[model samples]
Target: MKKFATITLMVFTLLIGCTPDANITSPDESTIKSQAQLIKLPALKSGLKIETNLTREKYINGYNGGSFIEQFEFQCVTGNVIINSQLNFPAGAFSGGKTITQTFNTETASLEFGPAMQFNIPVKYTLTVSGLDLTGINPETLDFVYVAQNGSITGVEYDSITMDVATGTLKVTNAKLNHFSRYGFVN
Candidate 1:
C-alpha cells in the first residue's frame, strides 16, 4: 500500500509538470539585430508576380527646376520589386531655387527615393508597401510618404499557395517628415 501510494503521487506530479502553459510562444525573441546582414545592390530583377491594381495622385514634390507631379498605377501579372535608388543632396541649407541633387535617403526626400525596408520586425510579414513619399509644395519643406501593402501570410512552405495572392492596397497616411528626427523614421 505504501509503495502504491508513492507511485500514484509520482504519476500525478508528472502529469502536472507535463501540462503546457497557456502563454508559451514559438518566437524565442521578437527583435532582430539590424546589423545581421546588409544588402546593397544597384537593382534587383522582378517578374511582376502580382498585377498591381492601385491608383494615386497629387505627387508634387520639393527642390528647384520645373516642378512636376507624378502619378502611377500598376497591375502585377507576376514579378518582383526590381528597383534600386540612391538620392544625395548638397549639404547645408535649402533656398527657393537651389539645385539640390536628390538621391535615395532621408533629408532631401523625394517621391521615388524614400526609406529602405527594415528586417527583424516583431511580426512575420513581408512589406506589401513600405517606403516614404516626398510631395512638398515648398522647395525647402519635405513631405513624408508612407506605404503599407496588403498581404496576410496564411499558407506554409509545401502546401498550396491559396493565401499568397496579391490583392494589394494603398492607404495614404498624409503626413510630413522632419529631417532632424530622421533616425527614428529611416535607417
Candidate 2:
C-alpha cells in the first residue's frame, strides 16, 4: 500500500510539472510585430479637421418614487476622431425626471453638462478624448479640471487620468460630479 501511494504521488507531481503555468505567457511573433508597428506609428499632428457630434441619449424613469441606476455613453465620432463620455447615475440620483445635455468643445478640449444642478447622489463621469494633437505633452502632468463659466479653471480631486501616446487619447476615470458644469483635462 505504501508503494502504491508513492507511485500516485509521483504521478501527481509529474502531472503538475507538465501542466503549463497560467500566469506566464509569451507573446507570439505576430503580436510582437503588431506592437512594434503601433510604436512606429507617427504622432497625430495638430489641425486634423476632426468633426464632433452627439451620438446617443438615454432616459430613465427615476421620477415619482421610482428608483433606477443607469449609465449612458455619449460619443462624437468622425473617421477616428472620437470624444467618448460616460455618465453613471446612482440610484435615487434625481428626485424627479430630468434631461441632461452634454456638449463637447473640440477646440478647448472641454465638455459641458447643462442644466447645472446638484444631484442627491454623486454621479461618476468618465471621458476619453481622442484625435487631438498631444505632442510634447506629458500625460503624467495632466489633471481633470473644472472650467467655470468665466473661464477660470480649478483642479478636481479624486479622479484618475491616463493617456495613450500612440493614439493621442486622454482618459479621465471615476470623476465624481455632484453638480453639472464644464470639465476638461489640463496639464
Best by lDDT: 2
Off by over 4 Å in 2: 1-57, 61-79
Question: What TM-score number comes out for model 1?
Answer: 0.22
Candidate 1 stretches greater than 4 Å from native: 1-68, 78-94, 98-111, 114-167, 180-187
lDDT by residue (tens digit), candidate 2, 36-141 = 2111112224554444423233454334323222222222322245667778777777776676677665445677786678778777888777755567666555
lDDT for model 1: 0.25
What is the overall TM-score of model 2 with all chains considered together?
A: 0.60
State the lDDT of candidate 1 residue by residue for 3-81, as single tens digits: 9999999999888766764224442211221211111111213443432222122221233213222233222223222
Clashing pairs counted in every model:
20, 0
Q: Each candidate's lDDT (Cα)?
A: 0.25, 0.61
Alpha carbon lDDT at 157, candidate 2: 58
Which candidate's TM-score is highest? 2
